[model samples]
Structures are given as structure tokens and as C-alpha cells.
Target: MDTRRLTQYVICVCVILTTVTLAQGQIKRCFACRSRGALGDCKDPFRFNSTHLVPGVKDEPCASGWCSKRIEGKKDGKDHDLAIERQCLQRSPPDDKERCSEALVGHRKIFICFCYGDLCNSASGIKPSFLLLFIPLAFQMLSSRF
Candidate 1:
């Protein structure tokens, strides 16, 4: 192939590779569980017991690239029942920060945290990796050379 044609071919391959790499980061496997009354293993003080199987608790792929854990209950009472839910987010939250926020849904108050990365919604809170941020910049620099 000619020099120009070869350069174009190399650029095409690089673009394709970058796209694939970026897409891979968006796919995450997160713990999925929901418990209303019994508290089970889904509540705070989450026990990640792999040896003993727990019903309604498992890891599943999150297509939205975000996972969330939500706890719902009354703010004033210790005796009030609390609900815990961990699942893949249907859509990305407004803020990308990996932190917890308190919100009221009707009469019930909830504390929810959203994060990106595999199983990042665990008891440790959000675990976002900043490494993925450099991929696009690197690709841009590479393409500029051509």
C-alpha cells in the first residue's frame, strides 16, 4: 500500500480499538438485592458471603453503567422498618459523583448512593476509577498526529 493509504488504515484501526476500550468501561456487574421487612443480608453492615448462597442477592450486569444502593425509612425513629435495595440504575443519575445523597420520595426518606465500576455500590460506597478519563484524551492526541 502507498504511504498515505497505510497511514489512513492505521488511523482507522486505532479509532476502532479506542471505541471498543471505552465501551468496555461502561459495562459493570453489580450486586442486586431488595429487602423490605426482614432486613436479610441486604441492609447496612452488608455481608458479602460468597461461600453460603443468599437468596435475592447476586451480581448482574448493569447496562446503564451505573449501580445504586438505596435505604428507605423514617429519619426520626430507630424502631421504624427500613427497606434496602441494590440494583442497576435504569438511567444515569444527574450527578456523576460517587457519593450518597438524601432525598424524600413522597413521605418516605431515602439515602442512596450511585457509582460506576464493578460492584462499586457495595458497603464501601462509590468506587470510581479515574483511569478511564485518559483514554479519550490519548485517542485525540493520536489522531491529531495524522
Candidate 2:
């Protein structure tokens, strides 16, 4: 191949490789579960379970997933609750908690915390500290490239 053609081919290959790597990296696969029935129902509203969906296998797509829910109520003369509804959501809820109101599920006071990232809805629930750390790194990468 001529010099110009050869240079173009190398650039194309690099671009393809980088695109594939970045695409794979962005697919935030998280532990999939729900607090319904026998799924991930929190029997103890104050505690969180660490049950993940297959340790190393990224089974589900979590592009915009979050996992934070707590529901408490009384049943059968005992206090029943569901702590962390650890799972993945296809898209985020439409309203923020401030604007999002609560509802009564048969005397259960359900509290939901919406956040973003892989398994980020855990106890921490999308920490600003992480965003603070991520912003500078992203800025440096983009600025350095320019």
C-alpha cells in the first residue's frame, strides 16, 4: 500500500479497537434482583444483603441501573421489612426523591433512593465523593488529548 493508504489503515484499526474497548467498558452490568415475593425481598429493612448475580459474570445490562430500597411493616405479630432491594433497573425512575412522593403498600412505609452506576445503590447510594474523583480524571483525559 502507498504511504497515505497505509497510515489510514492503521488509524482505522486503532479507532476500531478503541471503540470496542470503550463500549465494553461502559456496559455497567450489576447484580440483578428485586424486592418482590421470594426474589430479593428485604425481610429486615435495616440490613443489606450482598447477594450478587454470579461473581465474575456480567449477566445483565445496567447502563443506568440503581439498587436502593427499604420497606418496613408489621405482619404475623412481627416486624417485617425489606432492606436493600439490590437489583438493576433498565432506566432510572422518572422523578427525584425530593419530588417523588411515597405511597402506602398496606401499611408499609416504603422509601426509595434513586442513584446511578453499577451496584451504586448499595448502602453508599451514589456518593458525591466518587463524582468528585471522576470529574477531574475525565477532564484531565479530555484536556490532555486536546
Candidate 3:
């Protein structure tokens, strides 16, 4: 092949390879989504919360397919639980605690200090607002003793 033609061919091949790599990188998924037939009841209301469908896939790119729950899984006036976050979706029924626990499983990938309900205790470090709320009560107790 001529030098000019060979250079063009090389450029075209590089472009194709870059495009494929970029496309694959765009398909990342959340760490919580579980396998269920077509989102099942594992979804959230779009108007109130941002949702990630097919959440727990390992290297899938995140995509926006959110809708305002055009349908309901109501059973006797109660909404159906969508297993959109973690294995809670695959649960049989009436296992609310399991769902909650899974939801709070924390990013094990994050530091252990931040994993799951670490903020539940006083030792987690108090917010100034919360300490402010107790100031009045402390003052009242001191005044009563006086």
C-alpha cells in the first residue's frame, strides 16, 4: 500500500477502537441492583427520589430510565415493594427487616468508619445543631437545682 493510504487506514482503526472503549465505559451500574424480571417491584417513585435501575450489576454503566411510577403494585391499598436496591427485591414476601438491612449494608468499599449505621451513636461525632437542642434542657436542670 502507498504511505498515504496506510496512514489513513491506521487512523480509522484507532478511531474505531476508541469509540468502542468509550461506549463500554459508559455502561457502569450501581452496586445494589439485583436480578429480577423487568424491574419487578424493585423501583422507586421518581418524583420523590432519584432511582438507579438494575442497580447491582458489576461493571454496567448507569443509565437514566426513571419514570414517575406510572403503575402501582397496590395490594389492598398498600404499595408493592420494589426490590430495586440489592437482593431485597428477590425476597418472597413479608420480610421487611431483610429489605431494610440490605439497604443499609453500607459501601464496604468505603472506609469502615463510614460503613452502615456508624452515625447512630453519640460517639460518631455530634452535629452542632443537635448539641444546641440540648442546651436549653441542661440549663433548665441547672436552674431547678439552684
- Against the true structure, whose TM-score is highest? 1
Candidate 2 stretches with Cα past 4 Å from truth are 1-25, 33-60, 74-83, 96-102, 125-146
lDDT of 1 by residue, 56-104 (tens): 7888888876888998875345523778888888888776666788988
Across 26-135, the per-residue lDDT of candidate 3 in tens digits comes to 54332233323344433333111123223333222224211111122223333343223321122223422211122223432211111111111111222333334454
Candidate 3, after superposition: displacement of residue 121 in Å?
28
C-alpha lDDT values of all predictions = 0.73, 0.48, 0.31
Q: Is candidate 1 or candidate 2 better by TM-score?
A: 1
> For every model shown, what is its TM-score relative to the native structure?
0.60, 0.41, 0.26
Give residue 30's lDDT in candidate 3 (0 to 100).
Answer: 23
TM-score computed on alpha carbons, candidate 1? 0.60
Q: What is the lDDT of candidate 2?
A: 0.48
Candidate 1: residue pairs that collide: none
1 or 2, which is superior by lDDT?
A: 1
Error of 2 at 125 (Å): 5.1
